[model samples]
Target: MLLSDLSLSRRLERAERDSNARFVEARAAVSPDVGAGWIDVGGTYAMFDGVESPCTQTFGFGLFTAPSSGDLDTIERFYAQRSAPVFHEVSPIADPAHLELLASRGYRPIEFTSVLYRSLDGDLAIAAPADSVARPFQGRVRIVDADEVERWAQTSAAGWSDVPGVGPFLVDLMRVAAVRPDARLFLAEIGGRAVAAGALTIDDGVALLAGASTIPDARHRGAQLALLSARLAYASQHGCDLAMMGALPGSGSQRNAERNGFRIAYTRTKWQLSAGTRA
Candidate 1:
């Protein structure tokens, strides 16, 4: 990662933060339990959705910013106040002071995800599997409709079966994305069946590519690449300078994203609050 792209790096971090906040806020519109308003924990922004189904990392805590060491106890109390875990991400661009404070308070690293980006200066290659040479998913990346929200949520949930009970949250989030300014929800389909879903969130000319998911039967096909190509084209057409996404580093998902032109900017670490610090 180039140090000169600090602006891009920070935006990428905020892209993750702001989009998720939007989801939590948007989700509240469709379901009371899914989206609660956001709050700031010390210096970090906290998204509250009230659901205990999955990790609260995405919805509750902002990355790259940490509470002051003096406020560490207070933040822990805040999470404890809600009976929520003190989960948040620490990225390369985050304030070093934050990580130091987290470490002192017994936070343990739990997850790692690579932040990737590519300039949208030109057209992207739509790479598909050879056996599926018919290119069935091409021209199938359409903007999602409100009625298709459930389908989008279903595909996302099934795509990540390891994380149970997240379908409703994902669906409600997309429902809000459909109407938000500069936010676009997309899906790829064949024969009227939705095969994949992705979201484009543009901020200050940088488009954040998120919520990419494909069903089990649709795996190994170019559904994702097709969605990528469509989103890239759409973002570029709308004057976004670059596009960004995240994936687990060294995982096949990272390789796929790299093949599609995204390069790692940095990998952020998700830290879990140790039980000892609950209150």
Candidate 2:
């Protein structure tokens, strides 16, 4: 495979594994009044919900493609019973029919994102901020430990407030990080106060970066660079040959990934269908 394709595959693999792990963690924490189900319908799979409010269940294919009518109906039913908003994650390779299906049912197209990848096999380097921005950040980066889970979760919530399902989503993320040594959470501290946080999940030969955020007050202060530098270095030393991150369309996060050596391999869109909507 080409380097970029290899990187993308590795990234998708890491995402799938981490997502599955997150689901298991979330299921374990499900409230007594909530219910959850995992369904595999041929090529399409879904994490279904009989859950409480403020939680979302996702439906999509393991490998992006069009679903058969029967498979689509299964997906529809899975969401219908829950009465909650349902989301479908679509990659560039998603079947055109799937998009048509969602549109016909009023499942508006929401966010568009680019998947970026960087090959670590070569001499991968990231530029440091100017001395003015870099000097004050020295020795201020630290990894989030058990005691800092709540703080990290709060930081994530504040950073991703516009994203749906964030509160429960981040709580579940931190819960997994708490027990998984392979999951690294890095924070940038300024004057002994944590101001930014990011996470790295290493699986196979790929290291996927996720949940990167900096406090509004901390922007342009080298906090993000510090966290990224720390994670990349750690990944390199541990034998990872690729780094990947998802970028929201036209967002600064996308710009940062490009500036740091990651190249856009492909774009993906998230399609939504409400539970009660027609299939």
All candidates' lDDT scores?
Answer: 0.69, 0.65
Off by over 4 Å in 2: 1-24, 30-33, 48-66, 101-106, 128-136, 158-182, 274-276
- Which candidate comes out best when scored by TM-score? 1
Instruction: Estimate the lDDT of model 2.
Output: 0.65
When summed lDDT is taken over every stretch of 10 residues in candidate 1, the lowest stretch is 53-62
Query: Which pairs clash (backbone N, Cα, C closer than 3 Å) in model 1?
Result: none
TM-score versus the correct structure, for each prediction: 0.83, 0.77
List model 1 lDDT by residue over 1-279, tens digit each: 234255666677676677767766665676665436566654355556663633245322323444565455555665666677777776766666666777777888988889888877766775553344545554377887767666776666556654677656665444555655556878888778887888888877788888788877777667887888889998999988778887888987678778777788888888888887653
Q: Which ten residues in a row have the lowest lDDT in candidate 2?
A: 50-59
Question: Model 2, residue 207: what's the lDDT?
Answer: 84
Residue-level lDDT tens digits of model 2 in 92-141: 55455766666776777777768887777766566653333434454477
The prediction achieving the highest lDDT against the true structure is 1
True lDDT of residue 11, candidate 2: 55
